[model samples]
Target: MAQAVELPDIQFAAEEAAEIQQNIISVYEGLTGRTLQPADPVRLFLSSLAAIIVQQRVLINQTAKSNLLRYASGIQLDHMGLFQGAERLSASAAITTMQFTLSIPLSFPIAVPQGTRIGVQGGDGSIFFVTEEYLEIPAGGTAGAVSAVCSSPGTTGNGFLPGQLNVLMDQLPFIQSVANLTATTGGAEKESDEAFRERIRTAPDSYSTAGPQGAYEYWAKSTSAAILDVHAFSPGNGKVTIVPLLAGGQIPGQNVLDAVAETLEDRGIRPLTDQVTVTAPTSVPYNTNITYYISRSRVSEVPAIQAAVTSAVAAYQLWQKSKLGRDINPSELIARVMTAGALRVVNAAPVYTALTATQVAQEGMTTINYGGLADD
Candidate 1:
């Protein structure tokens, strides 16, 4: 069987003006029984004039074709407000929990006002604002946990550590210091043109009155680009369960879960009878132990090789997590390790118990132990 050739939506290729003028000259010469050379003054003038006229027509045609393609495919659409009539979902900011510790116990509760700025150095230097008006630090308690969100929408808000959030605003001195207990997650960059194009391309076939499985999955992902993976399941009639994982493969926090649920509910796309429950997947941590054989001549490159292998393993883990319920294949991971410019993979043993039905891979949880190279 022959494969079908996929053609571009719009035809933009055009013959050059000079080429068109040459063809016209060839026909004219044949009719007049005269040879027209570039050096001939009359022929040169006519050819130049014809080429310019042809060039203007070509530019007009190309411009019209480009506009038609953009309008038809909707590739040039910008901002979420322009998407999916009446069901627009805006970009979301990353949110995380921050811990505040007081140097000494106060006689009364201390209030950390809402919109208090807490930040880390470098990167986007994004500041996280307290979600509520007043997060109280109880008397005699040295520590308190409060929710905070990024000032703007993007992935730069994620990954702050405990000591990194040292900056605090004036008036919060009673709060002593602030730090993030958990990795700041759920931050995602704005959607790209290609990603939105794919969604629009598939939109027609995915429409359903009762909210088909594909529709649910699509809408769930549309909630946020940071939502790396979404799994929708219906065990029985009128029951829908959604599991969303973050970009780094860990389950999303409560804020993300709530946002997804609210979007689904507000969209009214799901059938009224269906009971939708949005939740995070259980985390399954995996580690690796590998022993590689290195050539005696390149013993000094051990550190570089080890770093490459570790990076490879980390990438593999992310790929595995992107697809929910996929088994962790040891052989595939070993292939990744061997491809890191190593002399030979003498032996590789990945220590991981396969995930259960409701589990997803966790990021920064995998540990790769590189057993010293066995000189060959």
Candidate 2:
């Protein structure tokens, strides 16, 4: 995986009080032809003036950094993206398929009113879904499924597993049960400054129409802010396959894949000769079985060492699966645990396993066993 964009600390104007005071004293001496020593009254007065100058320079530095992609944020970042016709994405509502079942098959189509509210089991069927077009179960059919959007936008309505939402807020005659068939997904918060800045930096890749690799990457990511990594490659002629990985190593479900596909399949955006396909990456499972010991000299700090080791292991798990095609390297885990003040560390599972560009190494089970205190 490539490193994130990093810009060195930029000083548009010096904000240090000591430096400003020295420069001011030098100018005062040049103008008045006087030696300003530590006991000089004018030098003491210039100290306060230098403090005021420092505040002005702080504002100047902030204004300067706001123009660069690596440092801009909020409205400043938005303005930079406008040069390339890119805009920050707003929060969006999650979506799911609501299945409404009737007690028995009806000779005529049973109406499932548009915007019928189906709440989770505990919410008293608080009508969550926004309005949808009219849908009805076909004649002689006992059930039908229609797409539903969350009334509340953003991730507030996301992550509802199948069947978790089974209560029908609105009572309709002959409706036996109501539940969500698919997991609620696609809800996302507004794009963050870091995510939007990267887009603005890569926005130039979209200028060409020849189906460049960067263009495919930009288009795939533009579909959703949930996407963190995109790998676009061509296995053969005129065929392009793109694999997108979400944040925190969550694999893209069918709904997410469909959304990416739709975004890349636009006729105006896609070339006539190119055939694009969107797919999820394969997941390779790995287990974390670690046993670590603490040094006897650090007995008094045993609690702190154990806490640090736990945090280290958790960080390693996230780093391992954060990117697509990351290898399963137990050595990385050992290094992290050792750095966290462990005297000795042993990992039983997950030897180094190589992965293809389209496969992700996911953790299955984690067992962190402490081996008690030992000699240095």
Best model per lDDT: 2
Candidate 1 — which residues are off by over 4 angstroms?
1-91, 97-114, 119-126, 130-147, 161-183, 193-198, 295-307, 346-348, 351-357, 363-376
**lDDT (10s digit) by residue, model 2, range 12-78:** 9988888998999999999999999998888899988999999999999999988877779999899
TM-score against native, each model: 0.63, 0.88
Model 2: residues with Cα > 4 Å off, grouped in runs? 1-9, 124-127, 130-133, 295-300, 338-344, 374-376
Report the number of the highest-TM-score candidate. 2
lDDT of 1 by residue, 1-376 (tens): 1123466665455557767777778878889999988889868877888777687777766666644323332333543324443222356677777778898998888877777777675434436545444588888888887777888788767666546665675457677788766666778776655455445544543466577766777777788878866778887889999888776675787768877898779545778898899988887665555566556677788888888987887778778777676666777777887888566664344544577656775544454555565666
Error of 2 at 159 (Å): 2.6
| 361 Cα displacement, candidate 1 (Å) | 2.4
